[model samples]
Target: MCISRRNESLNVAGTMRRGVCLAGCALLCAFSACTMGPNFDAPPAPRAERIEHGEPVADVMDAAGAAQRFSNDATLSRDWWTTFGSAAVDRAVTDALVANPTLASAQAALRESEDDMRAGAGVFYPQIDASFGASRQKYSPLRVGSGQPPVIFNLFTLSAQVSYALDIWGGERRSLEALRAQTDAQRHALAAAYLTLSANVVNTMIAYAAYGDEIAATREMIALVGEQVSVTHSQFTAGVAAYSAVLTLENEKATLEATVPALEQRREQAGNLLAALSGSMPSQWIAPEVSLENIVLPAVLPRAVSSELVRQRPDIRQAEAALHVASARIGVATANLFPSVTLTAGGGYGNRSMNALLSQTGQAWSAAADVTAPLFHGGTLWFERRAAIDAYDQARAVYDQVVLAAFEQVADTLRALENDAHTLDADARALATSEEALRLVQAEYEAGTVGYLSILVADAQRHQARIAWLQGVAQRLQDTVALYAALGGGWYGNADG
Candidate 1:
């Protein structure tokens, strides 16, 4: 009867122990689901549909003969630079993307962020580790008042340990969330780098071509002025013109010649920039001969609404990711205010002899659950939470500022395009009128109806008009490039490509 009663008591104790374990597990799970701090939501897109408050972008057409059309519904190609229709430009951009060290650095940073996040994820699983050790130790029972003899022994141990810090308040989870957001920020940074690099390459190419064109036009002006100088000298020799008239023509020719060197210097600088962009020394690579006339301006430019612009720009996206990280950090800080629970289990074999370490007689094991709660920290935890909140607010403000800046840039580029077209149209008309006047003056001079001075004035006016026209053409092309860049260079659609 006593044996049966003892057996029943043992069964009751076992049931109670099982109940305690089950209750502990249930508590852990329930607490783990409660994540601290405010959840994050993306800011709403701007309400204004139009990028600019003024006239519709679509109505603004290029009036300089080649009408540039803006299409709201058209999709921008990922390889937007290709729209310029220059194979050399396409090749340059491709080479830059492949070989630029800055791009490679950004890519490497992105990979590092991803790897860090992966490592942080390990906290979600139990960490298991195995270890082996051997040590010589001396033991004395006299230290504990047992009055036994001291003994020296060699100890051998082999063990496996498992531990997991319960994410009861979601601190570790929030940390992981922050890491993931950081990874996202890195990804956007890489995109921003790619966009910036391509735009720089194209802009440098355009500048190089424009400078070349301007130099050629200046040389033509110099030649025209030289001819006038010869005419004035002949008139002076015939005693029909003053010496000052010849001097004036000579001065004009010298001024026009002076400009060529400066223009040549600018052209060389642009070429060197192109070589650098292509990840090569100027000595190793020469910029291709990309003429202003060869570059085909894109006719149909893609125009995105304000909402889409927010989504498309890498800077905006990166700002958003930063906001996300800040939000997650707030959670992490809040969770820090609560208790952390860590569960550990260890099983080992130990013996004086290495061969006997694995024997059942030498077996040992342990299991424990530790709970550490912050009782007081001199307001450190509380202030940290406040700091995280401040950081989140700061990130949110930065995000708003970034969005505003992006809109401002797009609006400004759009206006510049419209103005460029108008300026180009006016400059073309001016050039034509000046050319006609010069032609008439030359005819009159040949017929002996006008003096060489009249021809000189007309030629100078035509030269000025030609320079203005060339500038207008280059400006229009550059503004077109700006519009493409302002629209985020279609990196979103062409990220993989």
Candidate 2:
């Protein structure tokens, strides 16, 4: 009997030592184990060797007398708007960045995503909980065959418990990785918002300035037409010009006057849009006065390479981060198919008398380990894993689509800018010819060498040419803004900007 008892004691000691060693090894393995899942790597470079758009040629056409050349490999500053050399433009963008609701929302979303990632990291450590309880119970001595009266008793308990999941298969690590990728995606999205907001403010301001100039030019035309109408009516009264000629002059004057209201209306609309973009009510906001003459176009524009474009564009980077997150999720789903091992330990003191709970003799302790495996779940785990894989494939396709669209935008902007220069040159030439024609005819009419109708014809043509030229100039300016936006708002760095 003595030998048996000694053997039992040895066996119990051996079990306790093995349990401790096993827990220690699990902790070490948790720290050292590799994460399961296909590791995320940056997508490979596009196959195409060069940008599909034509290479930046020399300054071919002078747009509004402001010529520009594309300089490849130049570093674009984050404050690209300041390059326009317009104080009003710079101020407008600054205000919008500070006040815009969309940008604020995006920034808030980024912060939330980062916090979620931080929370997910807690899974790497153990979970601990403290608990206390007090209860009244009745003892059942009759069931125990003690043949004694049942007694009401008070039970008090206090305990602390600890649990940890050994990440042998790396599900928790993959979950954290996925969350980190999501945070990265939100950060890129915020950058994209900044780029978009700034670009919109700049473009809107350009239109506002153009509309103001157009309205002024229209008023000038109205004045000229009014003078031409008086001269034609006097000629008709003298019987030297037909009444129809006077009617034509009157009609031209009215038409010119009519355009003024439309231009004014458009200018007002632009102001209202600027108000919203700057995050204010129209009544409370004042749009800056801008004109083609006052705004300076960039003389040397930076051009990024196709490969660099993917790296610089925020949307592309955002999409790539999403892809990484999707890829990581597949590992999380796959890990669910395997067994989950959990270790739990608890210790506490309990006694029928609350005061006796402090005694060492009332102390108790317990440790347990649990392993759960999916034996049958109606194929749910299998389908979920498959769904995760499909989701990853979908993300890959979407990433490819984003890259293609980004390149397409860059190409469109390049072509628009190239064409704008030529169009501006043509418009400028037409304006010069129209002004000369009007000049000669007006001088002749004053000298009584040409009929009043000749002056009316010249004025009409000159009015159209001036307005067209103004529109062309505005197009060139807006296109420059477009190029900046297409290049992903000039975002690029090793870390968050």
The lDDT values for all models are 0.87, 0.85
Model 1 spans > 4 angstroms off: 1-32, 439-460, 494-497
Tens digits of per-residue lDDT for model 1, 1-497: 99999999999999999999967865775565777777888899998968876776666475658788877676666689999899888988998998898999999999999999999999999999999999999999888999789999999999999999988777888899999999999999998998899999988888888899898888888887888888888988999889998898899889888999999999999989888878899999888888888888888888768878877888998999999999999999988987788999999999999878899999999999998889999999999999999999999999999999999999999888888888999998999999999899999999999887788778878988988888888888888888887888887853422
Q: What is the lDDT of residue 357 in candidate 2?
A: 84
All candidates: CA RMSD (Å): 8.7, 8.5
Tens digit per residue, CA lDDT, model 2, 276-325:
88889999999988887777788788775776788888999999999999
Clashing pairs in 2: none
TM-score of 1: 0.90
